[model samples]
Target: MVGVPTAIAILAFEPPHGATALLALLLLAAAAAGFREPTPLWYIERGWAVLLAGGFAVSTALAPTRPILDRSLLTVAIAGATVAAMGAVRPELLVGLDWQVADQFERTLARYDFGWLGGPPAEAAVRQFAALWQALYPAMLVLASVSALAVTVYLLGRVRGEESALPPLGRFRFSEHLVWVLAAGLVLVALPVGAWADRAGGNIVTVMGGLYVLRGTAVLVWLGASVISSGWIIAAWTLAALVLYPVTMGATLVVGVSDTWLDLRSRLGVAGNKE
Candidate 1:
């Protein structure tokens, strides 16, 4: 919610290609989440995600031309404050997932060194791309902060057993280990962005802020999926797509199907029972 709105607002002021990319990604996410399993709750939650994503995309498409710094700073502030507050309350929410993703991304970067794939790796290319990314990183951080804050509040409400204030669905009750895995994955992807931004002399706070936004957005998308599908398996697959794209999506689907089969076997007493 925070990210979509903030992105829209920022793009409205100073349109950028990156904003379009973010908006497109969000739209794809909403469409993926909207797949049906024949439930009222599913329709409602998926509808919300789709609506929000569309709103953001349309806003970005029509965004006006303006100075990047001026447009981004305001958006970043709004997003950062929200994410920070969320994190302070629910520190465990995103940090673990962020770490995991950051680790995986680092390993991938190390192995392929795709820098060479794009012609001879040049310092100038890396520097130019890094600079552009650095400039945009702050906005990402701010949006992440908002997402973290929202998740914390949601989790805290769940912990206190305050179901009334939550969404129509109850608090997410997935395994803690799973949450940790997701958090670690998020951190893994963010590490490179953070490093690049820092080396480019981007503000550290802004960099951290963007990292959190990226983390928080991932969490929000996951939560949204969980709400829509009423099953962690679906949500997990959706999140894998959001974070790791095609590769993670494929892996998650395979794992989810296996887990589902095991669950069915256990439920039918076929796995651990004597006939």
Candidate 2:
């Protein structure tokens, strides 16, 4: 349900199991039309999409408009709706996942930080970092939500076999345009435009750093197949990665940054985008 994301806010962090169960029934109906009833995927998607959108709106409309949830919820609702539509033809993709994701984001806004872990001796620095973390939490939520969706899409697809709602996984590649993201974040951190700008910049680094790591992993996978297909070698690399984490991460970051020009994957003739 597209609007079911707002229902997440209305339900206060835990998605209603009732709506989820109902959604499952509707999804089954849609799937049936596709596999058995000679139904157009678009027709089923259009019908249920409208129904889901209404439910989502009703839930959001009912949420208590306190402090920031009023505004942030709307923005997230829009984002969740967009994500939902991206897989409209797949019933499982409409699995009210955005609700769970919204709940996690809600909790992050409420209380997510390294406070329990503690850091630095300077009181002022600690408070400043806390404030910064709060500002960046939204961006974190976006990345986390997207990641969860990807994982869910994959896992659920596995369960459904050929009937998997989402499409198959393709080759991985980070965008060259994201290279500017790294530069912008560095500049923002180096020179504070404003508190908001600084927060955004730092969060950009966080998100983009994650992408870089993914790119690095992609490189490793490609190399595993091309350089040496030995399972033992791959296992050794994994062990090394676990043991030398910071070094591995730093190396990945470097590779990711250099990829803008290197296009290492392309050079290896692996997953080079024709586009």
Candidate 3:
């Protein structure tokens, strides 16, 4: 079941379609080989994974013109965010969102008759947007993908009998060594290197920094929950996110990176608590 989605992701990522397809086929075959007496839950999960993969393909097809990697990441980001949101609000709605998004995009694009607007200014704006997208979309995709997977695993555990399949969000953290990866990217970007090096560095920093931000949020949540009610925590987070978005995100990112060394969660005194 896991191989199914893993294979789908691999096939979507790179060039050399023939090679990727062959690799995916081999993975699927191996997964099939390991299949034993299947349970109803197994079929349900398999079907869900297939549906999600199909939706990703459809969404990718519907995406606006972009580099292959950008399009793939955008599709994954959109699908993952949609899935996560649906999971939080109404898990049952998860199945239809991808199709709906693709349909909506198709309809909107069909209605768009204008080729270009504002000439040079518009072109410049678009170039800027592309640069920003290249820098940030990797992070968005990483966060969204993890959220979607966590939701899936949580739901699976709820439906079937198992120990906790997902850990408490408050306890989330990545390996500390990942900070070095982010450092290397930042160094590359700062150095008087070529454009290719800067682009690669920007992507690496964006993705790894996003992970650290998540880790920082986990520490904050754990500490906040220790002293405050959930209602207050939610209220504070909402206010900070909506009214001071830049500040909030920056603080989280900084805190997250600092926590890599400080171990803030442990120092804060509720590090051992699961909830």
User: Best by TM-score, which number?
Assistant: 3
Write down the TM-score of every candidate. 0.25, 0.53, 0.54
Query: CA lDDT, every prediction?
Result: 0.42, 0.55, 0.62
- lDDT of model number 2: 0.55
Stretches of model 2 off by over 4 angstroms after superposition: 1-135, 155-160, 163-170, 273-275
TM-score of 1: 0.25
After aligning candidate 1 to the native by TM-score, how far in Å is the CA of 68 from where it should be?
7.0
Worst 10-residue lDDT window for candidate 2 reads: 64-73
Q: What is the C-alpha RMSD of each candidate to the true structure, in Å?
A: 21.9, 14.4, 15.6
Q: Pairs clashing in candidate 3?
A: none
TM-score winner between candidates 1 and 2: 2
lDDT of 2 by residue, 145-193 (tens): 4454344333333433536443222245645776797789878877957
lDDT of 1 by residue, 110-179 (tens): 5645465575466456556645554554345444433533443343344345775333321111222333
